[model samples]
Target: MSAFESIPHFDDSRAAAGQQARVEDTRIAAQQFRQHMLNGPKVRYFESFDLITVPYPVRYGLRNAFSRERFVEYMHIQNRLFVVQFDTPDGLKTLLVSPSDHERNIETPFFRRLQDRTAAWLTKLIIKRQSSVPQILERIGLRPEDVDYITYDHLHTQDVRRWLGTDKTPGLLPNATLLVHWREWESAKDLNPYQADWYCPGGIAGIPESKVIGFDGSIMLGDGVALMHTPGHTEGNHSIVVHTDEGLWVTSENGVSVDAYAPLLSTASGVADYAKMIGTEVIINGNTLENAVDQYISMVQEATVAGPSRRDPRFPNVFPSSEMTPFWMFPGTRPAFYVGHARHGTLQRP
Candidate 1:
C-alpha cells in the first residue's frame, strides 16, 4: 500500500476566515515537516533540461503590469525538468518532475492555432539541441530504466504518451510509473471549457492503468521529499518540496519568479510598487482567473512551507518550475532575482 496521509486543512473558500485558516494550517504543516524531516537523507537534485522559452502574458504574470505600456507584452518563461533521487524505505527512488516533452507540447490548441509560421520559427530558433531530457539523462549516467516515477505540477500543455507510451508506440522509460493526483488525471482526460485553452487534447490517453499511480491528498515519497497539493494554478496542482542542508525548497508554477512570492522584496521595475499599491502579500500568475482566491491562498502556503532562501533571506525558496528568465527580446520583463538551477548532493547509482 502507498503511504497516504490526509492533508491537514485545505480551505479554498472565499471567506476571510477560510483564507486565514489556510495560512495557519500551512504554517503548522511546515513546522511539522521541518521538525521531523529536516535532517533526513537529502535528495540528489539536478536540472535535467533547460527545456524551452515561451511567451507568457504580462497581465497574467505581474497582474498590475497590465496597463503599463513600458513593460513588454509577454514575458519569456524558461521551463525546466528536474531529476530528484533519494533513498526510501522501499528502495532507491528517482523522480522526474516536470519532464515536459516540448515538441508534443505545441499541439495544445492555443499554440496550434498561432498562424503565420510564428510557432515553427520560434521553436527552431529557441529550442537548444543539448537541452533534451534524453541527452541530459545520458550525460548524467542515468539509463531510462533508472527512473522510477514521472510527474508534473499540473498537466498543462503536457503529452505523456511520448514518455509512457500508447497501444502502438513504445515508451521512452521502460520501467517508470506516472505519479499524479487523481483529480488532475481525471481533469486532463475530460477537460472543461474553462480548462480547454491550456491543456493538450488526448494528452493522457491510452496508457495502461497499471502504469499510473493516481493519488489523493499529500504524499511523502520518503524522508525529506513530499508532493503536497497546493491547487489554484489548476485544481490538482501540487508543489515538490525538498529538505537540504540549506533549508526547504518548493517548486511549482503558481508564480513565475522570486518577485511573485516576495513582491515587497522585488527589485523588478514595477512589481514592488504594484504590490504595495494593492496591499497584497503575494501576486498570482493570473493566467486562469477561475479561482483567484484559492490561487492566492495556495501561494501563501507555498511561501510558508519553503521558508527563507539562504542566498537571499528576504525571499522564500519557492521556485517556479517554469521560471522567468531574462530575454533581450522582452527587455523590460527581466526577473530581478531568479534561481537558475538548484543542485543538491551527489547522484548515486542504485
Candidate 2:
C-alpha cells in the first residue's frame, strides 16, 4: 500500500483552492483530528531532554523586518529531544523526536564554514550537552533498545548511524526504526547547494533499508500521537502533534520560540512591533528560504492545530524543537515565554 494510504489524512478538498483556502481547510480538518485524538488516549508519557545550546543568526530569526540591527548578532537556541510513548492496539510504542548527536553535528557546513568554525571554537565555552540520550533513558527506567521509533522535524544536521547502527558498529537502539518523510529521506541523500550548509556530511549513510520507514502526509502512530507533514523549512519537514489533558501540542523547528508562532501576543522587546509593522501573524524560522510560502502556510497550520497554551492562552501550544532560551551572554534575544520542559502522564515500565 502507498504511504499516504497507510494512514488517512484529514480532507482538505472540502474547501476551495487558494492559499487562504488551504489554511481554512487545514484548520477545520485539524480540529476534527484533534477531537478524535482526545477521545483516544493521552500519551503514556511525555518528556523533554535538553541536548545542546547553539547560536543562530538574527536575520533568520525575525525575517523581513526593517530593524534587523536592533537585536544581537546571534541568538542562542537550546535544542531538545522529546520522548513520547503511547498505547497502540498491538502494544506500547515509544517515539523519539530530534535525538541529535551534538559532537558529530559540527560537520554541518553552516555559513559555508565560517559559522561551523565559530561553533567548533565555541563548543567548549557554550555548546554543552545537558545530558546524553542514553543517560536520560536509563534514569527513566528505560534502555535505548526500548525505543520503537526515531524521527525528527527534518534531517538537517542529524546523523542516525549511531542510533540504528552501521556495518562497522552496533546501534544504541537495536530495535528502533526511523520514520521519515519520503521527500525528506530523498532530500538528505541528494542535497542541493542551497540545502547543503545545514546538513551534516554523510549523515544518513550505512543504515539498512529495513531499519527505515518512509511515509507521506500525516499519519497517526497510535492514540494521542500523530506526525503531520508541515513542510517548508525543508521539503520533508514535519511536526509532532500530540493530544494531552492540557490540550493539543505540536513540536517542530519551523519557529524558534513561542513568540515566533504568536507574534501579536509577544511581549518581547521588538517582536510585537515588527509584526504590527509588517502586518504579519507568524514569524518564521527563516533559515531556509526555498519554499517560504509553504513554510508560512505550514506555520499557520501548526498554530491552528495546536490552539492555545493552557498556562497562558495568549500563546499557541507549540514547542519549537530548538527553542530560544534566555542567556546572559545574549542580550535582547530572550524569549517572551518559555515552556521549559513538558512532562505529562506516567512512564510505563517494562
Candidate 3:
C-alpha cells in the first residue's frame, strides 16, 4: 500500500481527534516560539500574523520542477510573514523579514503543465484517503489575503512592485530605507531567467549601473547598519548586519532555516548540471576530496572556514560562503538588545 493508504479513514472520529491534536500542537509550537523570542537576549521583537501555508506537494513541485527552481523556492515558499523590531540607542529600528504578500498560482504555460501533473497526483492520493484539498485547507483555517508590510527573507517578482509602492507612500518616516542584500539586486539574470523579462532592460536596467553597489567586504549604511556579502547559494546573496544598542543582529536573505546550513545532497536527477554540482560540492565541502570520506568532510568544513572571502565592488560578490554566523534564531535561542539604526543612517522609533 502507498503511504497514504496506511493511515486511518479521514472520517473516523479517532482521525478527526488526531487532526485536532495536530492543530493544537502547531499552535503550541507557534506560541512557544513567540515566548522564546520575547525572552531572548534581544531588546524587543515584533511579529505579524501568519497568513498562508504553502502545501508541501506544491512546494516540492515548484522547487524540483520549476525552470528557476532554487530562485523561485527561495523567494516564495511556506508563506509566513513577520517583522522584528529592535531597540537601539537611537530609538526603535524595525528589521522586516519574511513577509509573504500572496500565494501565487502557476500562470505560465510551462508552470501550468507541471502544476497539472502534480495536481493529478495529489487528486489520486487525496481521494484515496477520502479527503480533498479544500478539506485540508479548512483544517488549517488559512486565508488568502492575510499579511503585513514586513521585511521578508525572500522577495519574488510581486514583492518588488509592492516594495516600490511602499517606498513611495507619503508621510511615512522617509528615514526608513529598504536594506537589500547587494547581491540579490545584481545577479538577477543568472539566478532567475523568468525575471529577465521584467528585471532586465526596463527595470533594474533603468537604474544607472553607478548606483549599484557591488560587494564590499562590509559597508556601514550609516547609523551603525551594515551590509555584508555572504555568498554561497548564489553570487548575489548577502546578509544585513545591524548594530543596535542591544547587540549586532544579522539578517540573511537566503538563510531560510537552520536545516539549510546543513550539507545538501546533489541535484542530479531532474535537472543536472555538472558544473553546478562540482561548484556546490566545493562550496559545501571547501575543496575536492583528497582523503577518506570523513576526513574530506573535516577538510571541507575547515576550508569553508578558512577560504578567501569574495567581495567585488561592482558584482555584489560577498564573502567566502553564505553561512557566516553559527548562531540561529530557533525556538529557544536568546535574543539580543540593541539601539535603533535605520538603513540610511537616520534613527527613528516605531
Candidate 4:
C-alpha cells in the first residue's frame, strides 16, 4: 500500500512550524499521561548500544569549522550511531538514532547513485564501514519487530525508503515506526540544491504512511526518551535525548563533538581551543547552511536537559553521540560516544 492511499497527511510551512510543534508536544504529553500514568517528574534510566560507526570525510561533516590543522587541510573523521533501550510507560522500547545502515548502498536512487559512483572513482574519498540495522539487531538477539521506534536528528543523506521499504524492497523494520520532525519531512519533499547530493532522490516517496511518525517541537516517546527540536544543523533537525542513571545524553550532529556542544565549559576537545581563541562561544558542525542563532539556542537546550554530570560537576551531563576525534591522529576504527550501561538482550515485554 502506498503512503498516499493509507496515511493521514498534515502539512505546515517553516514560518508556522514552531507553533505547530508546541501544539503537538503538549498533545502528546496529555495523551501519554492519560493512557499511562508515567507522570510528573521521572527517574529516567536506560542502556545504550553502539549500532555502527560511519567513517566520513572531514570536509563533508565539520565543514572546516574547527581550528585544527586538519580543518585547514583535509581528512576524514568517523562518527557513531547508537540504540537506546529503556522502559517506557507503555512497555520496553528501543530508540535508534542515525540509521546509517547501508554502506555500499547500490540501491541508492538513480541520480544520487550516479553522483556517488562518479565521486568514489574520481574526486572524493568516501569510506563507510557500516553495519545494517538488521545485523545489529541480530547481534543483540532481537529483530526488526523488537524495536519500538527509529529516528534521526536530521535526514541528511538518509534514504527512508530503505527502512520503510519501496515498492520493490520490503520494509526492513516491519514493526517499528520511523519518527521524524514535521519540518524535516517537509524539507525532504522539497530540498534545496546544496543538500541534493546527501539525500536520496525521491527517497521518501511511496513508503507506507502507517509506518511513519512525524512530530513537532519536543516529544516524549515515554519516560526517559524524548525527541527535541534542536535545529541549526538543519532547519528541521532535532536531537534525541535519553535520561539514563548517569544523566541525559543527546544524539545529534548539531555539534560534531562534545567540545563543540559545550565550548565555553569544555576544553577536552581541540575545537574548544578554537572557540576560545576566536572569542566566540557558539560552534556549529560546519557543514550545511546553518542558522547560528538557532544553533546557539539549540546547544543551550541540550545542556539544560543534560544538567550536570554526577561523575563530574565541571562538565554538563550531556555527551556527543557523534564524538569528533582529531582525524589526523586517529584516522581509522575509533570508538563512538555512548551513555549508560548497555546489553544486547532480547526485547522485553511489560
Model 1 steric clash pairs = none
Between candidates 1 and 4, which one is better according to lDDT?
A: 1
Model 3: CA > 4 A from native: 1-43, 46-49, 55-77, 88-90, 103-158, 166-176, 189-216, 219-228, 240-257, 262-350
lDDT of 3 by residue, 1-350 (tens): 01011111112212224634533343343234323333434434432233432222213321232234333332222333334444444455554444322323233333344446666765343221222222322443422121111232222322323222332332121222344445556555354554332222322223323322343333333233434333433343334433333333444424222222222322322222432443333222111111223222222222222222122111111111111221121111111111122222232332
Q: In angstroms, give how far residue 35 of model 1 lies from its true place.
A: 3.6
Q: Candidate 4 lDDT, tens digit per residue, 163-257?
A: 77866778777777788888888888887777655676666788777877877666666655667777777888887766554555556777665
Which residue pairs collide, candidate 4?
A: 58-76, 157-198
- Order of the predicted models by TM-score, top scorer first: 2, 1, 4, 3
Q: What count of clashes does model 1 give?
A: 0
| Model 4 lDDT at residue 156 | 70
Model 4 ranges off by over 4 Å: 1-65, 68-76, 104-130, 264-270, 326-350
Top lDDT hit: 2
In model 2, the runs with Cα more than 4 Å from the true position are: 1-17, 66-71, 111-123
Top-scoring candidate (TM-score): 2
lDDT of each: 0.77, 0.80, 0.30, 0.56
Error of 2 at 84 (Å): 1.1
Worst 10 residues of 2 by lDDT: 1-10
Error of 1 at 213 (Å): 0.7
**Candidate 2 residues 233-307, lDDT tens each?**
898999998877778879999988888888876654578888988777788888777688778878887887888
